[model samples]
Target: MPVTDVTTDPENLTMTIVADFAAPVERVWSAYSDPRQLERFWGPPGWPATFTAWDHTVGGRAYYSLTGPRGERSSGSWEFLSIDAPHSFEVLDSFVDDEGKPLEGFAPMRMKLSFTPTAEGTRMIGESHFDSVEALNQVVAMGVIEGTKMAMAQLDAVLQDLREFAQGKGTQVELLDDTHVRITRLVEGPRELVWRAYNEEELMRQWMLGPEGWEMTECVIATEPGQQHRTSWAPVGDTPGEPFGFEGEVLLVDAPRRAVTTERMQGTDGPETLNDLNLYEEDGATLITVLIEYPDKETRDMILATGMAEGMEASYTRLEHEVLAPAERS
Candidate 1:
């Protein structure tokens, strides 16, 4: 319903769609920047999308699968070519296989999306450039225009759901699937500061401790892929609790934005989990999202039963009051 116009230029091998929304540019932009919000409306009505991987920085790639009502799936990948926050981003979009390899004989398209302020709200322009007329005609024949219109129509509900996506909601958890759990917290700080608080030993020692009466004893931060990072915590003074620690190998790092790591108990051979941390800033507050993939449903249930969400909330509170507050003051 937000779509105002849709056009296809066969001579130029391009298709453009224009939509207007009654939401601020930032609000509209966040819906696309965050994978959680994106998946809610990325696919058409009957085809819900699941983003298996999302790396939003330039040169990064995102892989997603759209599952049809009949259990069929269509996979796709986007290679980010350019990104200018709250303004524009370009990506090489492709039809991909399950493993994210582009399908043979299907040429990829270059799509650029832009967001701009309007008197009423925000206007979004999405333009796709195909390699040849055949390619452009091919996609149009496959219901691309109608599918896109249906997908964008769903964005209206997401933008209006301020309570669910707004800041200061504390740490919240969502069970994405049998093995994937997503935890999100909106912190009162900039993205850079939050990213630093997670990577710097001094800053982490100040707030990474969960609950009161505990102190961090060991902190080894990882700065690059494949590096090992470890942290340990012990109860201080008369506080009653045994010492514990976590160790992880960083699988990917895009500073100030995203990091992916493998985490497990320090000395235990227990199953490990994949943690994908993403940070996005809007209106001076940063949204911290961590998507955790457990080895199985049993492991997921066991971990959540350990008061992990409550503990994370405590840590995030400390992070704001102790780490970011001081940094902001300075």
Candidate 2:
């Protein structure tokens, strides 16, 4: 199938599966975030899964049943430990009885899903951790590996549906002046919702990711003037290096309208930038505009040479697919 590798660690009792998708990371993440989309690929070819309950928040639980061709049914449930949308999440997965209670004979395992952007598309890593090697081998004997591969292969079709839902021209970037750049986009959602997405720390993390295989490690936001706003990001996997961070102070705060801030790159000798963000209602959509003014032309050109605009485009695409599209649907 689309899976590139599947491995089991004997000492740790962990099974890891790696697969690549030919769609953006946001589009691929939709398969897991959207229940209807998840049902299309969460089971093997002959066994289709149907969810009875799906609660995605921390401590939330999900219940589903898989029906075989011959009418046989198997069910299970998941208890969410953590959820980081468009990035990764962890859950305690277990077999369940018809009454939705965990089966005493089965061993529960912790499962984690990580979505990382790639040049081609998204790289998804699925890992299952068991308490003992015997428990891991038991599930392997139950054909878990083959079933997982088949289920993941169905993601292509789900991605096609997501692409259709997320259709658009994409965001645009303009150099306003030698020391300033403006990024704009028409997001499909309510003005208030669009405003909230940018200001809220949880929502910002979903779409503000800068590049492939990188994620925000910390996010702190205060919407009041004179308050502090801080954030940091780093490579998703085991990459050696310190995280890149930004420290800023809110200069202006206008609810559902505009905001102004001054930000500086952490651990670098760089000039502080004045960031002006404004939002407007355009037709039935929200048009967002961001202006970043650097201290000098030399600093602006240097950042541009690093391909910041192209990376911003990728991030805004995620805004369209993950935040705006889902908010509109709901």
lDDT leader: 1
Tell me the tens digit of each residue's lDDT in model 1 across 24-71: 999999998998889867986546678999999999999999865334
Work out the TM-score per prediction.
0.60, 0.49
Worst 10 residues of 1 by lDDT: 160-169
* lDDT at 129, model 2: 95
What lDDT score is found at residue 138 in candidate 1?
93
- Supply the global lDDT for candidate 2: 0.80
- After superposing candidate 1 on the true structure, give the runs of residues whose Cα lies further than 4 Å from its correct spot: 1-93, 96-164
lDDT tens readout by residue for model 2, 1-330: 579999999798899999998988888877897777787679865466779898989999999997653346889999999999889999999999889988886899999999999999999999999989888999999999989887787677567643243236466666655776767666766678788887898899999887677899889987988798988889878754557888888877657866778888976556888777766554457667677788999988887787777777788778878898987787
